[model samples]
Target: MGIFKIEGGKQLKGQIQPQGAKNEALQILCAVLLTPEKVTIHNIPDIIDVNKLIDLLGNLGVTVEKLASGSYTFQAKTVNLQYLESEAFKQDGRGLRGSIMIVGPLLARFGKGYIPKPGGDKIGRRRLDTHFEGFIKLGATFRYNREDYFYGVEATQLQGTNMLLDEASVTGTANIVMAAVLAKGTTTIYNAACEPYLQQLCNMLNRMGAKIKGIGSNLLTIEGVTSLQGTVHTMLPDMIEIGSWIGLAAMTKSELTITNVNWEYLGQIPNVFRKLGITVEKRGDDIFIPAHKNGYEIQNYIDGSVLTISDAPWPGFTPDLLSIILVVATQARGSVLIHQKMFESRLFFVDKLIDMGAKIILCDPHRAVVIGHDFKSQLKATTMTSPDIRAGVSLLIAALSAKGTSTIHNIEQIDRGYEHIDMRLKAIGAQIERV
Candidate 1:
């Protein structure tokens, strides 16, 4: 059942919980390799990409045990360094994009790390240069095998130094931070990504006895430590998923509650949805999206110009949720421009929405104009393919609000990010089934 068969025009109700963050789980899971002691993590999302990383850790001889649902304990006391070069390791690493993150932890403690080209959503060109460059500044020798698309880094010992990242990449910063936690000197990372995910990693490392300062800022200073201890960490709710639920509720004219949304960490998400005139009421830690018996409206700029939304680093709108925002706008009351600054191919799925009667003009690969239908006419159901994780969920949201049954192929992309989405939606009155 790799496809989702959704019966549209259903009014969904009841509450849903956003799973642990997919991004944060990737970084935090890789960080278990930094220590040999037992580390327990709670709120772990049961998703494909994260499960792949956990299985990869098992292959590397990190003893992982399931303590309970959404909880696990891991110990890397006897890591199998030889597995790094095995054919089986190559295949496992190739299938998971999060596998690249294990390099820093392995290189730090074992003095060597090797990885085949990692895989994930084929959204666009994602460079590994920043990660390697950071490792190089930490005094690790880097080598690349072009024929095999393999990368390796080795050092007798890593000596940390000052470096400015070419781009504020979240994964790159996470990799560099993990490596620097075990280096011999001070490491100053400027222009580092300070997303909530990165901050969570730093906090977890500090709990494990690493010296990290300037969390939630672009400049991070890491005082190297000889070794780290084990600690427990609980992840924040997935803000992207919360935003998607907001979009889903608005599109379907349904009243829904999203619990324990971690409001402060949500940053610009609720506000951005408000810009589209979706009422997001906060009750305790939960988000209540009222049924839009009357359609929502898009707010104009202060000067009465069209509202423009764009993606940036942390404290800015996340690129991950722009697709949901775009899909929600198809039924709002005004026009808006969505500028997808980071990824070149992310906005390509708008054509699928267009096929379902959305009045979206693809301005380019990175920009689009969404003219809201104001619920005057419903989207016509259609079959579509999921291109990437975010786009896949966005399409699913569109299908759930369309006029008839809709079929979405390549739901594996969705499964990689959202945990038990079909089952959870079914619990909340969504007519979605795995077929």
Candidate 2:
């Protein structure tokens, strides 16, 4: 229950390199269980969730060696499968949603995988049906202990099968692909997630001897391989954090340079921010945001109607940054509609902004209309509790742009996703301290 005490309304300046893609790190880390050789990874983000998963792996007898900050080597050689039945495993496995991903590789390499119902941000009703259903399609026997809220998957042999997913779930696709890579035959996954993170996993798998095609497409074809060897993989910068920094610059009217952001993979983020009238400049893989001294403006549609910013699958705007976009829009020159299509409770945090004197209307559980203050009135700083990861960062951004000091409690939610966020903000001239 940490808290962040921040003195707001300061223009920040400096370069901030986003940590490794948190989403990708989760899936990639879980993939290490597919091989027995040493898997070296670079740019591993130092965050709570990722660290928890690393600890969970260590608890399961994976050899983890820290090479340096943001670098690590993992070897799952001689994993203790018996630990999966231990009470420690139930408690450790229930700690994060990413723990569910370990089940796929465990079922692929070993014979069984068991985990308690995973925990994560309370943003919405995140269902595990997709992951389990995909595993079942690949010939794994699935069992659920409703009384204990535990899940188990076991298989003597996995035979690949074609599956058209009900939704293009990134984790689901990654889990199923991990299992299918070691299956007996070819597996075709239609409506798969083609996000850059997933592509990184597929690419890494290919480098490790798994045959996968359609690298950046929704339809993935995988030829089961006998075994996978370990390979080195470097993660891309977190696009969500990059987007968050962009929103921070605009909201605080600061000039900030986000270095090494992997621009090509940042699909629709810059364009979507530009739609909010924020200037997004690309400088050699780095994003340069100049001070918005005169404040930014939201754009209207080509038909002169109100603009709507919404989230979709890859190549569309990410829902994770919708909260940031919503906060940035509060200080823009015009109005925009934010539609958080993936989750219902994400928009609930707008009330906190309203309390800070912003003009926002919660249209529904999933939609909100933001009318800019145009800097004519500054948000009055106040005490707020972070409800979830993205919302917490959004509130932090709001507090950074406010007129007075603000107190943000439950900053552990922010720490779960961002690596030493207060310290990073401090390096960028932001007045934020963990208290």
Per-candidate clashes, comma-separated: 0, 0
Q: Which candidate number maximizes lDDT?
A: 1
248-287 per-residue lDDT for model 1 (tens digits): 9999999999999989899999999999999999999999
Clashing pairs in 2: none
lDDT of 2 at 151: 92
Worst 10 residues of 2 by lDDT: 86-95
> What TM-score would candidate 2 get against the native?
0.99
Candidates in order, TM-scores: namely 0.99, 0.99
RMSD of each: 0.8, 0.8
